[model samples]
Target chain A: MTLRIYIPCDAAAVSVGADEVADAIRTEISKRKLDATIVRNGTRGMLWLEPLVEIEEAGKRIGFGPIGIEDVPSLFETAAHPKALGDIAEIPYFKSQQRVTFARCGITDPLSVHDYEKLGGLAGLKKAIALTSADIVKMVTDSGLRGRGGAGFPTGIKWNTVAGTTAAQKYIVCNADEGDSGTFADRMLMEGDPFLLIEGMAIAGLAVGATKGFIYIRSEYPHAFAQMNRAIEIAYTKKILGANVLGSGKTFDLETRLGAGAYICGEETSLLESLEGRRGQVRAKPPLPALQGLFGKPTVINNVLSFAAVPTILAEGSAYYQEFGIGRSRGTMPIQLAGNIKQGGLIERAFGFSLKEIIEVYGGGTYTGRPVRAVQVGGPLGAYWPTHLFDTPFGYEEFAAKGGMIGHGGIVVFDDSVDLARQARFAMEFCAIESCGKCTPCRIGSTRGMETIDKIIKGEDVANNIELVRDLSEVMRDGSLCALGGLTPMPVLSALDHFPEDFTPAHQAAAE
Target chain B: MSQLPRKPTQKTEAGAYDLELVREIAASMKGLDGPLIPILHALNDRFGYVDDTAIPVVANVLNLSRAEVHGVVSFYHDFRHEPAKRHVLKICRAEACQSMGAEKLFAEVAAALGDSAQVTLEPVYCLGNCALSPSAMIDGKLYGRVSKEKALAEVRK
Candidate 1:
């Protein structure tokens, strides 16, 4: 009998030397002439303990991690090694997660169809194949699933719109251009559970009557690109994709397109433009993407998570998914806890957990051991909530009501030593650099906002500059073309509102 | 694949042009709906940067104008016009990395790489390794929890 060892091939895991650890394990196994099969699995999302090795013992997997090459020999010897964590599933981090989208990640060989089937991978697609297009759309709608992409738009609503539209050539486009800082859920899913996304996309194609689909992934994720391409090829070979999907006689297939480092390409219209081989620029509203998109046809554009969640919705039944979460934000959110946090990783939870619980309990506080000053719930566009507001729930509207958004469910914590003024300036600077240059408010206002923030930081005309910066943010919010300019003010305003002490060196509030 | 329309006589003043290589790069992606970006990336990867001479060749092959190709080349910050230094150190400048002393680390790294011809320091928004902050990519490989000493050693080596 061969001992099965699982090591993550996830990009984040690889970044922190998972490959070296895997090589060391293989070398040691060969040196001892041990009967062992090393399987490269996706990350379990406990990133802090990556190169996380697991060995199947007595029908349960025992984990060992933050593992170096030196730890391998002893790992093979006994289960009582210093890094040994008994029964990987029992670990609190893995135990607590409500992993609907990421259920298969870190548990199965991403490229292996056999492993995927054993873990119930194709159940959703199998179910989807039996249902009518309207029934599939209704199932998704009843599930209460929304876009996991920043906007949180209802996924089924978007599908319904596209389904109703009659077009010669409809398209299903997956926005894999996850350019947001501190967000990697999409990348993780694509790399780890590649088949899940394929199944989800296929289901979406069936629901919306789209024959073809395209996943627009950023060029930065080379590992994901390779993994998805290989997965697509495998899915085709297995008839999960291609002309006759699982012998259903339905023609549905897709390909991955790489985006050239433009942050704006994360926007659906801009992503479509980039796919068509042009400069990524934002298009005007009216003739919404659902009615007319991607080569002037009705298109169903969704984030990677939104599509990935479809399989679960179809397989388990919509009511099973709708049971989780509070308010309208249904299902689970794969929150990427990052930055200065001690225990940073992915936490997929029902959408009602408070900010404090996520930060202190799950994240285990700051890595620096300093008092957490603020936490940004979303990407660069998300607001910085002060510690006093840590009780706010993680729902979409809950965060929004308190001048914050759970945009893409990425929470990046900052310690007390952080300069809020500098962060505000960075938001403006990032917008300036990444703006599509389609609108004046985002294009020029961002540059001007930076200058205002610099003036505020320098303690030059402190009171007036504060007001000016606020006014500029308001203009950018109301006047901008899309969320890029509109939402850029969230972080800026949140910082200015929460940490006024950091706005100036002088440290005095305006008389206003 | 059908042969790309290329002229060997089309040479730049630098005379370092590889028309066959340019055409081959573009020709390989002949059937792709939009081969422009991939061709540019391939050329850039091979040549270190997209040369001006190759732009016209790419444009010609893709049936696009040289100006349009140049627009794309210049639009992206990742696509450099000249060959990069011996080592490219991309430090994460986003909030997550900054939360873990990345800003201070970036300063230290910059100061260490000062006047060092072998290293080029660049600021990237994120590398998606926020859990392991103060991350850096040296010569395309990522190193998390990067200390000034480790970054300097990697860049200098």
Candidate 2:
């Protein structure tokens, strides 16, 4: 009898030597003359225990991990006596969460359509084809699924508008431009499960009367691009994509377009500009993408996670999907836990999971083993939540009430070693470098904001400069074209609000 | 007086329309724009980056000094006057990477290649991999949380 073992080769896992672990497992198995086949699976998202290996036997997958090359000998022995490896289901990391969008992540062979089908992959698209466009839209709407690409806009409403639009050349665009510093969930999904995104886009196309789809992936994600391209080609060969998919007589063609490394291009309209071979400058909205997008035709644009989550919502039914989350925010979010954290990777859980549970418990606190001082929820534009506010639930409404957006569901933890003042400066400088320059407040104001920060840092008439920073921040926030300039001030202001001492000049006399 | 390159006196005849069309587009935008930034970007889009031949064409189109165009091209990092080799590798030399011991990685890379960050190694400000730390770009592919050993190994591959 041939036994099979699975190990993750996801980028995050690879970063922490998962490749070496896989190599070790292969070498050890071959050396021992063990009757086993090794399969490279995607990460289980429990990154802390990366190189997480799993054994498949008797239709059950047993997990063990954070294993290095050194653990191979022990793993082989454990494989001989399955009970020696301990109960995989009982692991705290695996048991303490609900996974929906990531249901097939580590369990199935990432590129295998057969494994995916066996594990419920395109069942949603199968169910979706039987329903009308409105019915499909309604199903998504009832699920309360919101856009996971930083902005928590309801996905259904956007779909409904596009579905209702009367255009001959409508489009479905998947924003795979996961440009966040600490987020790799989008990249992981694209690499690990490219078919899911392809299926999701196809479903969106069917629902919105779009026959064409494009995934505008960032140039930074070459692995994802290559994987997606290969997956798309495979999908076409398998009849999962291309004209008359699944023999339903519905035509949807999907292609991947590489972005030229502009952060602003992540924005929908700006992305459209870049797609059209123009400068990535934010366009005015009224005629949102739903009304007129991609060469002035109706378009349905969604984030990677949003579209990836679609198949589950359709196949499993909306009620089943909605039942997982807390009030208002429904379904599972593949939260990307990163930065100065011990346990980092994708954590898929429904809303109402506290930030503390993720950062402290799951993350095992900071990587330095120091207590986490502050955590930046969401991406660069996300707010810095000090230790006191760690109890905030990972939901759109809750985070918004606390003056933060669950932007791309990324949490970057920072230890006491981090200087908030420097972080604030970085936000301004980042905005300056990334701003498209079409808007004045974003382009010029960001530069001026950096200068003001320098003056305050230098302790040169700091009082007025501090005031000026605030004033300029407001102008940038109010006057900027898009979220690039608008939300750049969030981190800066939040850092200033939370850590005022960090901003004060070193030479300043102590106040009585 | 230095004689300028001969200007296209008339539109080319049939059978060479594609080249003529490109020349027409390049000639139309001559010297109208404020700086060479837009022209460089436009030409780069047409031919990946500004080539040796493009500089003269761009200068002729704009009726600007060749040295002036070259100066403008060199001023901005975005404007690559020379054609980048098949693959462009950019290593992050920003403060985040510096703090994360990228300096050691940088030195190792330099020593192995007989070139420093300033000379041959393309030291980029940041590739937005601050959280991952020690990031580098190989052929526009961003690899984060890299070490000297890992980088060297990747480069070898």
Candidate 3:
């Protein structure tokens, strides 16, 4: 039997030298003249041990890594390499995850349709093929699935609205533009199991009565973009997409479109505008994308995770998915642990895992060994949570209650040495840099906010400037068109509220 | 499939790029849905950056105004107004990477390679490779857990 070895081709894995490791493994096998075959698979979410090499042994894949080219020769020399991580699945970080959407990610060859089907890929699209569009919408509704792209809008309602609308040519657009600073779940899912998203979009097209779909990925994700385009090509050639869709005699074809680097384009309306070949400017709501979207026709826009969830929800039934999570926010969220953390990686869990547990337990605490001073949950617009609020649960409403958001489910931890005032300024600066400039409040308020923070930092008229920041934030929060402006104050206010010492002038406090 | 710049191919009317070639590329992609962005991307791919002269040619083919075409190109950070250096290096300046001392890494890089004509340094919000914080991509290749030494060595090569 040929010895089967698996190594990840996920971009993050490649970023840290997985390709060099793969080459080393190839050379070692050839020089030793061993009967071995290498399979480039997706990451297992054990990112701390990335460039993770797995060898098939007695039906169990044994893991070893965060491997280097230097460590390659030792692998064939002895069964006991120092970095040997036993069984890949048995690792606590691997075992702890309630892997649902990510179930087949690291296990199968990403573009392999046979591997995708054998591991329960098309079961959802197949199941949806037998059902009416209304029944499909109802099934998703019962499952309590919501948009995974920061906004907690119900996916079924969005589908139902589009299904209700009668359009000559409806469209299904997958928002694979994962632009958040700490989030990579969408990228991981797209690169690791490109077919799941293809299957998800196909099921969506069938449910919404659309024949064409597009997955809009960011220009930054060239690896994922290449993989998705290739996978879509394979999908079309195999008759799995277009004219037949797994021989069910229904039609659905998916295309991958690349976005120019604009953060606002990640917004659905802005995305639709960009897709229409215009500058990514936000459009006012009244006609939601469900009713008037993509060439002024009905569109079903869902995040990669939201669409990827459908396959399992359709295959296993609504009740099975609904039973996994806390109230309202049903199903698992792939939480990303990033920055200043030792075990930073992807952690998918049910909705109630506390921020403390995620950061300390799964993340293995700060990478610097200093105490974690603050954890920013969500992306650039998310609130800065001081340690006192670590008990906050990881759900939609729960986070909202604490004036924080589970936006895109990304948690970025910072050590005690950080200055909150600097972070607050960076937030404003980021908003100013990325704002679509369609709305005055976001465009102007961000610049003014940055100047005000600088005044505070200089200790010149500190109190008034600090008050002005609050005033400016309140205006931007209410007046801006979309979340880009509306949520900018979350970080600004949260920093002032929790870490006032960082904002206070040393001389002024001493005088007081 | 490549997102990075390629070598300038076939000179144009203003000694910048080929005008007829621009019209041909634009017309070829005009049949695509939302073809304008793809058309601009094609020009950029061929010339390493969208030449200003090609704007009217592309606009004429797509029947869009010069302003509309220029607006889309200038609005996005990825579209360069002029040719990028031989190597383009983008450092992640977003929140996750920031927490991992990317600010310091950036400062060091800027101080070193900021003036070098061989490399054009740029700031990117996020690369979706956050698990490996302090990430930088040079010439469409990603590097993670990047120390100042590692980043300098990679770019200097």
Q: Write the per-residue lDDT of candidate 3 for residues A1-512, one digit (tens) a residue.
A: 99999999999999999999999999999999999999999999878899999999999999989899999999888888999999989999989899999999999999899999999888898899999999999999999999899999999999999999888899999998889899999999999999999988898898989998888899899899889988887888878798888898888877777899999988999999999999999999968999999999999988999999999999999999989889799999999999889998998888888999999889998988999999898999999999999998789999999899999999999998788888999999999999999999999999999999988987888889989999999999999999999999999999999988888799334533
Better of 2 and 3 by DockQ: 3
Candidate 1 vs candidate 2: the lDDT winner is 1
User: Where in model 1 is the C-alpha error above 4 Å?
Assistant: A507-512, B1-15
Residue-level lDDT of model 1, residues A128-185, one tens digit each, is 9999999999999999998999999999999999999888789999999888888989
Per-residue lDDT of A485 in model 3: 93
Candidate number with greatest DockQ: 3
DockQ winner between 1 and 3, please give it: 3
All candidates: DockQ:
0.42, 0.09, 0.54
With a 3 Å backbone cut-off (N, CA, C), the pairs that clash in candidate 2 are B31-B62
Model 2 CA lDDT for position A82: 32
Residue A158 C-alpha lDDT in model 3: 95
The residue-level lDDT of candidate 2 at A437 comes to 81
At residue A7, candidate 1 shows an lDDT of: 96
Instruction: Give model 3's share of reference contacts.
Output: 0.76
Assess candidate 1 and give its lDDT.
0.87
What are the lDDT figures for the candidates, one per model?
0.87, 0.76, 0.89
Per-residue lDDT tens digits of candidate 2, residues A320-413? 9899888789999888777777767777888888898887778887767777788887777888889888888878899989888889987877
True contacts kept of 1: 0.58
Task: Please give the lDDT score at residue B53 for candidate 3.
Answer: 88
Best-performing candidate as measured by TM-score: 3
